[model samples]
Target: MTEQLPLERLAYWLEKRPDAVWLTQPVNGRWHDFTWRQVDEQARRMASALQALGCQPGERVALLAKNCAEWFIADLAIMLAGLVSVPLYPLQSAESIAYVLRHSQCKAIFLGKLDQPEAFAAGIPPEVIRIALPYPTLAAQHDWASLLAAHAPLQVGHRQTPDELLSILYTSGTTGQPKGVMLSPRAFAFAASRSVVEMQISERDQYFSYLPLSHAAERFLVQMSSLYSAGRVAFVESLETFASDLKHVRPTVFFSVPRLWTRFQQGVLEQLPQARLQRLLRIPLLGRLVAKQVRKGLGLDRARILISGAAAIPRGLLDWYQGIGLTLCEGYGMTENFAYGTFNRPGQVCFGSVGRPMPENQVRIATSGEILFRSPCLMLGYYLEPEKTSQTLVDGWLHTGDKGEIDAAGYLRITGRVKDIFKTSKGKYVAPAPIEGEIAKNLWVEQVCLMGSNLDQPLALIELSPVAREQAPARVADDLEQTRQQLNAQLQPHERISHFVLVREAWTVDNGCMTPTMKIRRNVLEARFVDELAKLDAAQPLHWQ
Candidate 1:
């Protein structure tokens, strides 16, 4: 049963629990529920409409939307229509949107909630059919209501073979051009079902969907996992209502990135200062009560498992969550492997490690210190780029560009990216991630990027957290310098940071300094700060932009 494809699993749920509420969505502060039967009918209707639009079985269908109930329905409809899915990040630049639409040669697109629809609408080719979801969106030839009313529910849906193409998820474009990663039904089925078993997921679990569904991590973790486990999924209405919606859902299985987790922590500290909270937490009886109250307030009181991924989380942040009775299991994976690699199991978590490989996953270190993985869930190849595909997938092993070290206990610790490692003027190699992690332990810092390819010493570009921005400038600077000195004491002479350059603006997806997944774009930052870096003196400990 676990080996069945997601659509087959959806069918199983439709038969067993037709009336069960599988999706809950908040719109205009009102709750809208969709049962398994309704989900099936809607998906079928959309599938019929898509087929009616002259979409070939193997033709590409792009999904451009924020995380919503309709996003899931559209993706499933594409699968049911036998069309390959190509998801675009809703927050991506218009140029990126145009590039993906043109590169993938999508015949149609399903548009949903977007921040800048007008700015991006021109990216869609005129020939492509536009189907808009039930949201205030750009002008489209077909709308959700019209499509459902016009087409009957598809009686005979396309049954995907094990190795048939499922999706082409583009990379986050941290380095340069986002390569389209080709995935199949076999890849998702093996990874999601096995992950369900490993994580002990069940129908009773609840998932809060906020992350972009385009990313392989969120798609596999939230979307596919919910399909396999038959879990109820909920979507946030908007950023303004995120807090209220989160409280309303109270999801049992929550997956979040480091930046959001840090934001949550900062929100708590704003209401109740850390010093006061820490003092209360020291008391035996009062501590548990306070912790429980804090969890309840954060809407994580019902969470059975909390996962942190996408990037390395600061250890101090994890410890702070632990103090509040929330244990975050840090996992490691890549889009190429369907986000299945290593994950810290419940009750057996090792600090600073991503845990052991999955039961069926083969992991080894290359002589070049790169992490290599061969798993059933590995991607087929990159779309239309045979040379890049060959370079990535060699001899059945997925060459994960991450440098990692495995402990004697089998815990995998990601050291740095093989490409991200840089050399100083003296030709000494430096891995920035570990040093960035150390600098991130300070609550004042939000995002940090270390780059000094040809400089005498490496310097860090720091983005101050909201809390730090609100604090006294003198205090924040003094505290940051203290942290920098302590961090340098633990590092080798050449690896030590010469100066901490503070950026005035936050590195957001909109600003193009961060990816949609909240990872700092190193290349973008390096190029953006070339002029500033040249002016920085070695004697200066802190340079504010």
Candidate 2:
């Protein structure tokens, strides 16, 4: 058996299944496949190019690209050359990109397809070499093809230790400025091995890579796991074609965020009228047959495991998926720990909990209910932020900033962020995440943000589903009112949403209302909708005093 680390695993794949297809991409509407041998060769060439550019060991090389085969090639090259890889989300603004590049002191950057290169050009220093990816342009300052052609084949060695830094992932910075979470090679390997064990990922499994590689959860689970298990990974061409690409790949193992899963549910529910669906599901034999067909049509027929992480998944969505014979297991982790802190096993899964901690890690709920973790997978510390690092990691335990309770069965149910729990002026403490999760269960409501910081009562900002608007524009208001009434009946007077503002536009990363992981940025959302929320406060309620 091969050693359980990145470079060792890569060598194992190179020797064992050199001709096995490792990665596939759609370019100009055609599929391009790469074997393990081809991947290793390309990575070696890129490693040589990095060395030729005077990239010393431990230096950070940044890759700002959408999910592509070359992204993995570049990542492997960085590891092979004994350097650290820093992946950035392709959708991030030029300013955020510049901040990460400068903060990490990245020597070389691989810029992917961008809408505005001039914006990036203006922000980055002239000395920093910006290499455009496979599809080169005359406008690009440094051509990646020419650089690779001039470089010799890199010499591979076993110089990297488990403790050596492998990656520095920047958090989404929902609360404040993003911190660089430094993860070692061993940490990445441990997380990957544990995930494979828990989720039962194998070499025969196929994964559809769509999530942002910058995010640790996706990187460790999908990207690193590919290397460990020698699994094949397919990249979607664009966000617009994700559904089509998913059908094409028919991935055996998949992972997605909660928002996408909710959208999937909305899509299904929208196709059938609620009255018709309720009646149809009441039939025993026909309902089972219809559901089986629905699951197959949705390209989930082959999926053995579907994982959701990076945020809390609403229990309602979980049950809805379960009804359709799909198991959407939720996991929990952060950049500081390289993902896979806890995950629901294949057979032993729960609805709202993020399962138990992986075998390699130890987790404990603090006296105040904060989640604290200790593991070899834990990062060394934040890069260049010693003070913040000291505060976050004390006595070898990572203060996750999340409040949760561990059940008798060891499943971890995350309630809310410690800082996000707000107190109403009426002296009631409210955890908005659970409340928002409950409100989002309504199929018509796509996204909900609950806010009541020092206010008399809680209020919610809701984004309606596309189907809700197209099918019943006039009914949108009525449906929202009904939803509010239903939710209010379930909550105490202070915890109920006294009022809500209907936002037609979706909250997305581009709009700065959500993080890259699709978690709501409470500060930004509150600021943007302050006026609308204030207007709601002044309005009269139908039932409330």
Candidate 3:
């Protein structure tokens, strides 16, 4: 089970757990369950249709869809047809999607639940075939059920070898144009198997998949891991129904990003004032009742393991969740290696660290402080970028490009990105991550970005959370200032923030503040605020307007 490709593993479940539910999708506000046999049959039929359309082995097909049951079916169908799958982030802009389509030479697309049809449609050439998924927003040339009805299940006589190319996952670009990461079946399988062992995932565990399936974290952690463990995957339809979906699924193993985790923490705080909640938790019998109710309300009482990744989660956020009995273990991984290098495992956990390398992986810290690992899970190389690939993979070690420090106990604490370490005008270096993490403790501050290019000291630009957004401007200013002064008191002289400035506009993916994977676009933010941030250093920490 630990050594097989995903398609082979799926075949096993189809035979053994044919009656058990494998994928659940939310259709028209109603939950629909699909058995393993149903999923397999659909995928096999899709494979036959794809082959009939003349999609050749090793050719790339793009998947432009949100997280749904059909997304898995289409993905498996691609592999079953001996073709490579190239997933496009549903939120990707027309230009970006167009670049990917051209770059990957993808001749076909599976469109499903597109939020913006015009933008997605801009990428496709007139000649490329559009295969509709169950809930497609894009006008398509073909339908999902039609394909299954028209074609019989395709039969491939042999199992896909480990060295066979499985998919080319494009990196979630937080900085530049996304690069296609080439991975073999063995690479993804190794990662999924390692994650299963580390997380102790099993057949009975339930998985909630809401994060974009195209992202490596969700693809490997929730999707591929479910395939390997034979866990049931429940999909969320949209943001409005996240709570309802979670309540319905009550997933055993939950994986999420920091942004969503922060939102959950905020939701808890809204229900019970932080001080009152703490006071209540200290009372023995009442504390137990409070904890149970709180967990139940948040739909996490059934969750045995909760993992957060994509970016460093604030330690304060972790403590807040743990206070209410949800332990969020941070995970570390990347597109190049399927994001399975390290994880803060249960019982042997360090709060701020992403834990040690998995049992099957080896991590080494280079003299430059870059975290390096040589794993079977590492991708073959970046697609069509030989020079960049050579630069990243040197002497058999994959340079993670992330600076890290390993504790004496072997826990790995990511410091920041190598490119994120910037020198101030004072000629002192500052890493914004630790400083931002500390300041993120402030309840009023939803997010913070630190910048100090050519400035004597760094300045913090803060975005208020929804609760704080509703506050009077004066109150918001005072609270932000207090938080700034308190954080400054705890920092090194050079690292201390000189001033805090309220960001006038909220940063969002559409506004270029966020990447598709929900990571802050640091470079983009810094560029947008360079002059403004520099001007703020001479002024008071807050501006009411």
| RMSD list, candidates in order | 1.0, 2.5, 1.6
In model 2, where is the ten-residue run with the lowest total lDDT?
A: 536-545
lDDT of 1 at 216: 88
Select the stronger candidate by lDDT from 2 and 3.
3
lDDT (10s digit) by residue, model 1, range 1-545: 44998789889999999999989988899989999999999999999999999999999999999999999999999999999999999988888988998999999999999886898877888998999999998899999999999999999999989988899999988878899999999889998899989999999999999999998889989999999898999999999999988988999999999999999999999999999999999999999999999999999999988999999999999999999999999999999999999999879899899888986999999999999999889998999999999999999999999999999999999999999999999999999999999999999999899998999899999999999999999999999999999999999999999999999988998988988777889989988999889987767779999
Which candidate achieves the best lDDT against the true structure? 1
**Residue 385 of model 1: what lDDT?**
96
Question: Over the stretch 1-545, how does candidate 2's per-residue lDDT look in tens digits?
Answer: 22467888888888999999999999877999999998888888888888888889989899877788988988988888888888887667778878888899999888775545555665565667777788632155666678778876687643668887788999988977789999888888887876676666788999999888889988888899888887899998876777778888989988999888877776677676666766776699988887777677677878988899988877878887887789987889988988858988778897778998888689999998999999888888999999999999999999999999999999999988899999998999999888888877777777888898877898888887777767655566676678788988998888988886677678998889988788889999888876665555456442121
Question: Model 3 reaches what TM-score against the true structure?
Answer: 0.97
**Residue-level lDDT tens digits of model 3 in 123-194:** 787778889997857888899989999999987723688977788989878888999999899988888887
Which structure is stronger by TM-score: 1 or 2? 1
- What are the lDDT scores of the predictions, listed in order? 0.92, 0.82, 0.86
Give each model's clash number: 0, 0, 1
The TM-scores, one per candidate, come to 0.99, 0.94, 0.97
Better of 1 and 2 by lDDT: 1
lDDT, candidate 3, residue 275?
Answer: 89
Error of 3 at 150 (Å): 0.4
Ten-residue region with minimum lDDT total, candidate 1: 1-10
